[model samples]
Target: MATSSICRRRSLSPRRHLTTSPASFILLPLFSKKRTMWCYQNDRCKDNFKKSFRLLKGCASERLSALVVVLLLAIVSYTLYEVQYKTGIEIVPFLPIDDSGFETYNEKLLNDVVTSKAAQNQLPRGSLMCWVMTTSIYHKTRVNAVNSTWLPRCDSSHILTNSPRFLDDQIPYHTVFNSLPESYYKLFWKTRLALLYVYQNVSSEFDWYFKADDDTYVIVDNLRKYLARFDPEKPYFIGYRLKRRMPNNGYNAGGSGYAMSRAAMRIFAEKLFHDKSLCPYHEWEDYAIARCLASMNIYPLDSRDELGRQRFLPWRPEQHFHADLTPSFLMDPIQFWGPSIFHENLVSMHHLKPDEMRLIDGLLYGVSQGIWKPQKAPNSSTSLVNSTEASPMEDTIQPPTVSF
Candidate 1:
């Protein structure tokens, strides 16, 4: 059996039980991560397919039976050939790619949703356009709760789904007419495509961009005030920082949500999107976006309060506040449960039920108590608060001195 140890570092309150980076860390789940498991991806199953084919052939040697058997075998062989020989085509069963040789929705109609409206003209100075990644299944459930609760507070918000029927519902959704199937693993693609669309169409409208999930409950006013000190002109990526395979820095955790400056959004759309090596596909949505941002020298910044209490939490209030917690093997291993106390200026939290979101609305007592607004440090003029290693976005991405 393998051995593991929980090393608690010195801190005031609840501290980490283990010290491991996300790159080499994820462990202890009784079940392993799900595989795409395409039919052609498994070679061992080919023998079973061959056995079945032989039995079916023996069922009848009649001319019609033989013709049907030959047709089926040819189709199978051709599918295998396509998978093995073609590098461009991917047959991910869960996320079906649209190969109709055309875009799904009318581009003009889709762009018209936000193309004409200027966020800067209508909203506050530091306008934030929040994009919530959701699906058709949760269109009515979680999305409705989010819209009814905190989403309205945002300067502008839109639902990102492949479903085009949002037009019929008269909801302000930025639907990309594509055949991308809705699946948990496909979030990376959804996030990337949404940013690209926003950049191409309405980049000039918003000062900052915030992305979240259907279950995420964001204190919009808190987030807007928290990021007010940082110049949106300078690239800022702040959220629940998760240290992944990268050497020095980490990416913001996706569930709790992440905020990016106007500059960061432009850099990602223009520079990172064109380069495959710099912004390649990855399994996790947050990690993939972080990889792209990191290449452009925009890393996740510390979004904690002055006392080092996190502003972004990956779990609900009860999970963090609960005493006598039982350890679990299935829980996400990358959580940074510092001090076990909720910060007064917390901006976001994940894994919330619809009612829980409403419950949080009623309990906004601590939101404005001690907001961490970045200001002139003791002796610094422009240096940001809690950002010892962060710098403004450069003309070109600086290669990290060291990386995985």
Candidate 2:
């Protein structure tokens, strides 16, 4: 009975909850709150660090991508430059712009010309006139050579000289102009007079006028081909252009010969000849014409070959034309007075003796008929020629100024 009472007493004594110790009950809640706060702060710091890392990674990625793009662009540009250097073809010459801010030769114009030429079978032969500048004494041989060779290629041809002669069908120019003594100094006057006479007398018959010296050898077929690209109605002057020691807008080297459109000729006749005081009378007819044309704003066209070589050659085969290059044919005693590289398409050669003219006449005729092969000269190397040098392809060429 005493034990039972003690057990009941013990059971009833702590009817108190035994879930926690006394010390835990006092400090556990506070410790739990402190741990939770520390965990929350640690989690916030981790999130902030992760966000910062992600932003830094994104910035690095963008910078790397931009760097990669710049590198690729640089590589591509270098590759193109290398390719252009390796290939000999130049799409654009060194100096593409002229002093006047116009493109000297544009790809667009070339394309247009080529496209237009695809359909035309041949340039109209009736539209051309060839004028041979000759004296009375040498007409028999030189005139005969032209007649036998290239003169027949034109629609009409005339000899311009101031000489009285017994009228022969072969030599009609004797009666063409009143007798002016055949002097070198009087050439400019004769040329002026000839231009005036032709303009007044027979301008209605032709659309294009070609002027050549007696010693000049011309490929009329090639000339016609060249002329086909331009319209006769436009004021175009085509020739071997000379910038050095020329008038304000450049002039044609007369030894190589020159061609002027009907419109250009009309301007010369109407405006240039009438004003005797416009330019001083000089011995060089070609320079005088250039000065006269410059005043009227008619500039010379650059008439180079497909290879960018001058079609009209002024120098003989033995002479040096530029500082770096000499013009010559490979064959000893050159039949053609041009660099052998351009022999196949030789336009005009200067200083052709009357006999040599006859020989070339036969050779050129044979080539035209495909019966003869044009033999290349053995040592005639065209390595030194850079069309960009001394050509209209340069930047700021010597401005054209009149020379006596």
Task: Quote each prediction's TM-score.
Answer: 0.57, 0.55
User: Which tens-of-lDDT digit does each residue in 1-404 have in candidate 2?
Assistant: 34434334434644221112132234445658774345346755456446535544555576688799999988976666554433322335551211120122112222221111211222334688787777657656776676566766777676665453422554435233344455665576667666665555545446788888888888888888788889888888877666544534567878768888888888877777657556435556777777777777888886766555566776563452422232222111223323453555557877887777766776677545554433332233334264323322332232223211
RMSD of 2: 30.1
- lDDT, each prediction: 0.63, 0.59
In model 2, how large is the Cα lDDT of residue 301? 81
Model 1, 141-251: lDDT tens digits are 777677767886887776766664433343556555244566554566667777777667645568889989889999898899998889889989989777645536877
Best by lDDT: 1
Q: Residue 117 in model 2: shift from native, Å?
A: 36
Worst 10 residues of 2 by lDDT: 110-119
Per-model root-mean-square deviation over C-alphas: 25.5, 30.1
Query: Model 2 segments beyond 4 Å from truth?
Result: 1-125, 164-167, 174-177, 320-344, 367-404
Best by the TM-score measure = 1
